[model samples]
Target: MKVLVTGAAGFIGSHVSLYLLERGDEVVGLDNLNDYYDVNLKLDRLKRVEQHKNSYNFSFVKVSVEDKEAMENLFEEHKFDKVVHLAAQAGVRYSLENPHAYIDANIVGFMNILEGCRHNQVKHLVYASSSSVYGANESMPFSVHDNVDHPVSLYAASKKANELMAHTYSHLFNLPTTGLRFFTVYGPWGRPDMALFLFTKAILEDKPIKVFNYGNHKRDFTYIDDIVEGIIRTLDHTAEANPEWSGKDPDPGTSKAPWRVYNIGNQSPVQLMEYIETLEDSLGKKAEKELLPLQMGDVPDTYADVEALVKDVDYRPQTTIQTGIGNFVDWYKDYFKVK
Candidate 1:
């Protein structure tokens, strides 16, 4: 299978590309390598994938998805069996600042992806959605069946729009589109903007980490390995039109067309402070905390209801926060040479 992975230079996208390569699949990696956080870190992830260039099938292209001509040309060149659309302008707080980035990448870019898949006869299109779509919803465990019309940030709004756009394509052209609403994904080679990476860096430098929501927040912190596993499983299992679905009382998760959505998460939400403590233990350093109110476009808690994912793909994110943090700390030490 020739798999096209957008955002292949990103933290999760790079890992997904490697996993596909290892499983005897050809991969065409694409990314703009924009400095959303740090371009060097993104390139470092690409370097790790390049190490497997000998046996595994892998090719990389430096292009943004927003470029309609480049994206259409790439699709015309390679009739990809499957596409993992992981590229997008990611970051909640950053969305508050540069809202146009979200529009260009998440909105316009995703539209291009849907268009390419429609015309090129792609088999499956699996794109990355986020748990941030559960904005302002106080549901105990965020479910795909729940209404997600209220997104606090433009980033979240763009992701929600992606799901809708995918559904429209699936319905109109009968494209198989699956949207995975990912929780807080973290591990080795994570984005510097993410909480774990920032907290770890701050703690190591004896800097005060801003404890958002006064450390009262809880997150379903998912490991990269688990995320990759779920993605592979989903890619293999292309979505199908639900037989029992009806328009009268429509199911939010499944559609009459081959469109679907699922929550990819640990199912267990951990406190923000507890995660910091785990990181501290891993690095043998205590973080100086500066408690602060939650920033705009931020949610107080995020707990994913992954029952649908578990039932469909046997996707159970089993990495404990302690173990995952330890693995990340080891990688950080090796990557940065922190003595």
Candidate 2:
């Protein structure tokens, strides 16, 4: 199968691309190599993908998803069998600082992807959504069935908008679209902006790490491998219209059209302090902690109810925090030459 993976140099995108290539699938990876965090890290991920000992064809293109002309040309040229759209301006607090970035990347970029899939006859379109969409809903174990009308940040709102837009395309064009609301994903080659990476770096450098919400937050941290596995499984499972769906009682997760949404996350939610401690243990260093109130666009906790995903894919994230943190620390030490 020929596939197009946007954000291929990104944390999750790189891993997913590698997985596809190793399985003998032709993959065209695209990324703008933006300076959201570290361009060097993104380049390094691309290098790894290219150097992987895989039998399949793999290529990387430097293209921004927001560019409609480039995206349309690429879609028309490749006629992709499947597309994994993971590119987006990610970060809750950053969204507060630069709202326009979210609009350009998440909203406009996603529109191009939807259009590409619609015109190119893509078999399946699996795009990234976020657990942040469950904002302000004081519900434990966030489920896809739950209504996520209230979003605290523009980032969350953008992701929710992507779902809505995807539904529209699926309804109007009969395109099969699936949105995966990923929980906190962390592992080797993880983004520098993420808490796990920041905490690990700060602790190793003997710098103070900020404890958000006064160390009261709980997150369902899913491992990178598990997330890639879920993505592959869902990509293979083309979405179909839910016959039981009704207009009178609409389910936000599934629709009468060929569209569906599922939460991809570890069922376990770990306290922020516990996560910090795990990182400290992995690094063999203690971090100076500055306990602070939750910043704007932040939530106290996130726990994913992945029952629907488990029922459909017959798989669930099983990586423990200890193991995941250990793997990350090992990778960090090796990648950055941390003595």
User: Which candidate's lDDT is highest?
Assistant: 2
lDDT of 2: 0.94
Each model's TM-score?
Answer: 0.98, 0.99
Residue 151 displacement (Å), model 2: 0.2
Q: How far is candidate 2 from the true structure (C-alpha RMSD, Å)?
A: 0.8
| Alpha-carbon local distance difference test for all models | 0.92, 0.94
For each candidate, how many residue pairs have backbone atoms clashing (under 3 Å)?
0, 0
**Model 2 ranges with Cα > 4 A deviation:** none
